[model samples]
Target: MIKAIGGYFGLEMSRAESLRYPDAQYFQSARACFYALLIQGKPSKVWLPYYNCDAMLGPLQRMGIDYGFYAIDEDFTISRALRLAPTEWLVYVNYFGLCDRQQAEVLRRFNPAQVVLDHAQAYYSPPVDCLATLYSPRKFFGVPDGGILVSNVRVGSTAADEEASHQRMSHLLKRFATSAEAGYADFQAAEKSLEAFDVSEMSQLSRNLLACADTPTVIEQRNHNFLTLHARLAEHNALAFDPSTLNGPLCYPFLNERNDAVRPDLLGESVYVARYWAECQGRCSPASWEYKLSRLLLPLPCDHRYTDADVQRVITLIEKGLKGD
Candidate 1:
């Protein structure tokens, strides 16, 4: 499974057992964190990466927030920007589980209190302190709904009892009936309606699934599988993996010289590789598009659901696909 999904050095839970509410769930969804930040901070100007999910821009625009795009290096790290504006808010993404410690430090140096770390991808490895840290739980676990907005800034009172109950019920219903097709449909409907969907509504069943998350074991296995696949595929000159400082990785993203040509073969191997942020609104600047188009990112299943044998099978399929056999 790890080989199939390709998240060799990705995020995992810190604990196996679950909690009652916020404690149990780390981050909810990238979209949720995006919304929450807009609601809570209400900053005038924000800075984000050009190579991020397009879904994020909608909320920012809806909130009438102006944003600037920063340039990312070949390694997908944001090392340069046009200029440091009076940007009251700055959003930093922990891209693909690769934490850019230098960028974080730079942001702090400029304006310590203005940075918001979107740990949606690099939740497992976080800085000791920051103004705010956001997470998307579904990215790591089997939960249907949940997100955390950790901040030094406090908000007003909690949701009313009836409102909370109604939201919870709606979440449960959505969870019970959700399928890939249904989810796609829902997204289409939302796109038509111009209404943003909140991802914090997990069903009881989904919550139960969260209880089974085992962080340490998952991390160990994922790293092992990642190393194995990396070593095995290293001989293939046509395929190259992203070299990053990953304590844990969320996907094994690689650059393929023949990605457009070999895509069909990869799919036939049952390798459900993704273009990741291709459809993300205007987030894909020219540089972002060049990198994404030139690369094939594979998210290996690091969860407890997959075994070493599954990893080997995935690696074999990838090797065969690369060989054009």
Candidate 2:
């Protein structure tokens, strides 16, 4: 599974991790706060990455918030956009678990009051000091609906309602029965009725999973799986690491000059690989488009669910595929 899926992926444990409950469902609230802040005193402009989720842009659009796009260099850092304009609000992403402390420092120099750290990808080693930090638990852990937003700023109090709670519990029960697809369907159904302003319930199952998560073990497995993939794929002269000063890589991104030709061959072997971000939806830019097209990011499963053998199988398949044997 590690070989197939890739990245520090894992099945969340049942008991033993910390539980944040109402506070855990912070992403929505943070969005709400941003909206409220804009209404009270709309900033001149906000900045975000061209490569990002459409869901994030929804709130900004609804709030009538104006925004701009920044460029990600070959190193995946925002070095050039710092001097673009006097940014009022900046959304900083910890892309693929690579720490962006230096990027954050640059943003801080411009306007510390307007920076929002989107740690949705770097949940494992999230930053502590930031004006605000938002995370989606579902991406990293097995959760139905929960996100954590931590900040010193005060926002309105609108707790998760009963319907959302029931729906979340239903999803949990369905997931526990090993029907993940069914659970996901149910979640989608619930999302349809959710109001833009309403707060959704945090999944207890997700909280429990986080509390029971083995941090040290997960980290070790992730690093091991990543290193294995790197060692095996590095010999291919055509494949090279996305040059970035990443302390920890959540996914092993490789630049394949012949991706259009080689991708199908790899997939034919039942090695499911992703061509992540084939299309940039939100705020598309020339630099982002160029950066995205030249790369294929592979996630190595380093989560507790994967073992050493899983990593080996993935590498073996890659080696065979590369040889066309």
Write model 2 residue lDDT over 98-120, tens digit each, in one string: 55654555555655556777766
The reply for model 1, stretches above 4 Å from the true place, is: 1-15, 18-28, 100-109, 156-195, 198-208, 235-246, 280-296, 299-303
lDDT (10s digit) by residue, model 1, range 151-248: 66653323223333233333334535774343545434423322344534334444556666666766666666667667776665343445455455
lDDT assessment of candidate 1:
0.57
Tell me the RMSD of model 1 versus the true structure: 8.8
Candidate 2 matches the true fold with a TM-score of 0.74
- TM-score between candidate 1 and the true structure: 0.73
TM-scores for the candidates: 0.73, 0.74
lDDT of each: 0.57, 0.57
